[model samples]
Target: MTLGHSTRLIAVAFALAGPFGLASQPSWAEPTQGWKSYIERDYQAAEKHWRTDVARGNPNGAFGLAILAERAGDAKGATEWYEKAALGGVPSAQVLTGQRYAEGVGVERNPVRAYAWFARAMAAGVPNAEKLRDRLAATMTPSQIKEADALAETLAKP
Candidate 1:
């Protein structure tokens, strides 16, 4: 009878603990962990964990990968991952993509497209997007600025 009670208690404990343990493990935890490592400049570990998260289709992982690639001086890889993250709707990625396009970092310079993305990031309330937008506007000709504004307006619509 004592063994039966103990078995029941153990089963109950397992039942209660199992779901909590699983729930405590978030989908983003690994990617966040990788980001922590990246912030600490542990490039190898950051790449490893971030790659694991990327394999699971996490946009944050792609952002981390982009940062890591940039740190490693792999422009192509950084651009690709930044594109992936931006298309995934990561706001910071949108900002970085706009900056890249504006400067012709990995892709050709396209002020209209850069303005569109900066506008998107601005609408998304990323803190410094407006500053970048203003800076890009300053570098553009009146005609180019008009074109960029038009593109940004169109992109702002639902």
Candidate 2:
């Protein structure tokens, strides 16, 4: 290798080695350009890109696949991937999961659970979550709302 490249590689290796050594360094996965493929209207390529990370529980891959599934009219597949991404901490996936729960789409309708998911999205800094939470709250009775509010607070905690 060139001296410059070798120096950079050495620096990176040292950086990756922490106080606890290499074992303490965070593991990284390869770049998966799933979103780019999906945006280009290429479902096949998007699927291929995203599949590389799905087994590793990458939220971006799950979220991209969810969008692709939805575009292809596969509600079941969409919900499944949405749930995976949501659990993996994707804010959009959390919002979508909330909507699904509220509407009984590919899952049971449960407003309380929906509210919690919305709150979780809000906690994760998804700005659209507030409106959805407020709208859903309007349909609930005072007691149900209290429960949902409590759930929201609980879900918001780290």
Candidate 3:
């Protein structure tokens, strides 16, 4: 699907949140209160906390929501939240988003987009992101690679 102007703008903003076009790694030592609630199987409490965080523009909140959605078997909802978190500079979300794109789990499979996300994740120091990107690259035609490269370059701009 072609990204609209606002979507592209959001993508650019997300790209700006990270180093080399993706957000830096977040500290996982202190899980968000929402995440804590989720771990305790308090779905209602976790949703409330995560909703508040999302309202406050906290990407981790989006990440938490994604997890909750996944747990509840909402593949589409989970993917949407994951994309939001990834754009907001969550490295793990980026990888998840990339995987989703690669496999067409929630969204349509788009190798070019998948590669771009993987590139961003790799640049952000995500483990094995490079390997994933390279694997995807192996399946892409030269022109497709060029397109992915261009998209990655655009996303990399601060």
Candidate 4:
């Protein structure tokens, strides 16, 4: 589906929230609260809801908060939460974390680390991962690329 820049960003955040975007799963008794507020563009409400969810140790909530923080210009908050959710196996969050590392936005510059994250997210089957990996590779030396590939391989394992 086509999305505007803002919607596309939201979609990436929500894409991993459930099997579908902004739609709660039957597995949750109260439905996904963040999705509702996010769909309505009530980001403050969404942030509140996601914060609640995050406190409950929900990976989706962590991912949602990361996106909202990014939208709200809290790059550090976004980066922290993205790393948290990424470790929990949120593919989109993994991609976002990789991008952050690649750009040094709210994080230290580390191309090798960024390439590793892209590799991990790619292994997780995120869309456009191959393209992202290739783009970063262009800025890397052959040895750095090889190191990143190995690191990605290591991280990709269960």
Candidate 5:
């Protein structure tokens, strides 16, 4: 039985490795290449690859594409992609979307929405979010602050 189990494990490993071996590059290499293109300022190439990855449900790819859109001056596209990434649980995207809401960049300014997003990012452990949350708190009335805090607490719940 032990020998049979070991053989079965080895077979599964070989099956997984087969596709990787046959390809000149591993399947996961595309996302890395896409990120490198982004870092090198090749926005079009990065967008192409990242869009493909995003279509396949890659959260990092969605975040990268959103950031590229923002840097490329496509505010509408950036907002859409950033929202998608944030919904997909990318903390940086949540923080950026919140900042945009706070500053009235791309979208209309809405302090409540901004605070909610910052709170989400803070809950996710984005260290800078806490500072932003405090700053946002300073701009609100007591009731508004209480509302925002309640919203944040609700979002923090699993």
Candidate 6:
């Protein structure tokens, strides 16, 4: 069956659900040709496509930009884009953003923020996110855990 534009867009949104491992690209998944160019190693074309999508407020575009920035060793830019995508409700971006916070990559090291993002990712059904959140919780003080839980609650998608 032919997928509608919205359905194709939904597929694109979830395309990064795993670790940069999009094995095959469906023919109709070209609204954000960024992922296609990215897989083909055409960084320039990917960036152009992603930038246009980002301009149009596409979270998947933000996720694509985050991957490109990370590839270029621009930790700060990657973190910014990842956070944008995460806030826009991209589960993979939430995980990456959590890791950035956990590792102090491009952002200050804050276990609280890491836990919060991980919790959000877990709630969004990202596999292994609960493990990440629990692992981080093991190192945090009770008060910190409480704060992280509160933050995660506040940031939960409606």
Q: Write the per-residue lDDT of candidate 6 for residues 54-152, one digit (tens) a residue.
A: 787677788788878877778999899888888867787888788899999999999999999999888777777888899999999999999999999
User: Candidate 6 — what's its lDDT?
Assistant: 0.77
Local lDDT at 42 for model 3: 88
lDDT top scorer: 6
Ranking by TM-score: 6, 3, 4, 5, 2, 1
Candidate 3 vs candidate 6: the TM-score winner is: 6
lDDT of each: 0.68, 0.67, 0.75, 0.74, 0.67, 0.77
Extract clashing residue pairs from model 4: none
Cα shift from native, residue 35, model 3 (Å)? 1.1
By lDDT rank, best first, the candidates go 6, 3, 4, 1, 2, 5
Per-residue alpha-carbon lDDT of model 1 for 1-158, expressed as tens digits? Answer: 35443234324423423322111224543437885776676879988887887787777778778877776677778877876776665666777778788888888888878887787777666666788888888878888877877776665232
Please give the lDDT score for candidate 4. 0.74
Model 3, residue pairs in steric clash: 18-22, 18-23
RMSD of each: 15.9, 12.6, 9.9, 4.4, 15.1, 8.3
With candidate 5 superimposed using the best TM-score fit, by how many Å does residue 102's alpha carbon deviate from the native?
0.3
RMSD of 2: 12.6
Q: Model 4, 1-158: lDDT tens per residue?
A: 76655577766545533332221334433546787998888988898998888787666688788777777788898899888877666667778788899999989978888898888777776767768889999999999998988877765232
TM-score of each model, in listed order: 0.66, 0.70, 0.79, 0.75, 0.71, 0.79
- Candidate 5 has its poorest 10 consecutive residues by lDDT at 16-25
Per-residue lDDT tens digits of candidate 5, residues 65-131?
Answer: 7667666677877777766766666666677777778988888888987898788877776667888
- Candidate 3: where is the Cα deviation over 4 Å? 1-29, 156-158
What digit string (tens of lDDT, one per residue) describes model 3 on residues 1-158?
A: 99654334335434533333323334433557886776677889999998998897777788778877776778899889988987886777777788889999888899998998888778777767898899999999999988987876655332
Q: What's model 3's overall lDDT?
A: 0.75
lDDT accuracy of residue 71 in candidate 2: 66
Q: Identify the superior model by TM-score, candidate 1 or candidate 3.
A: 3
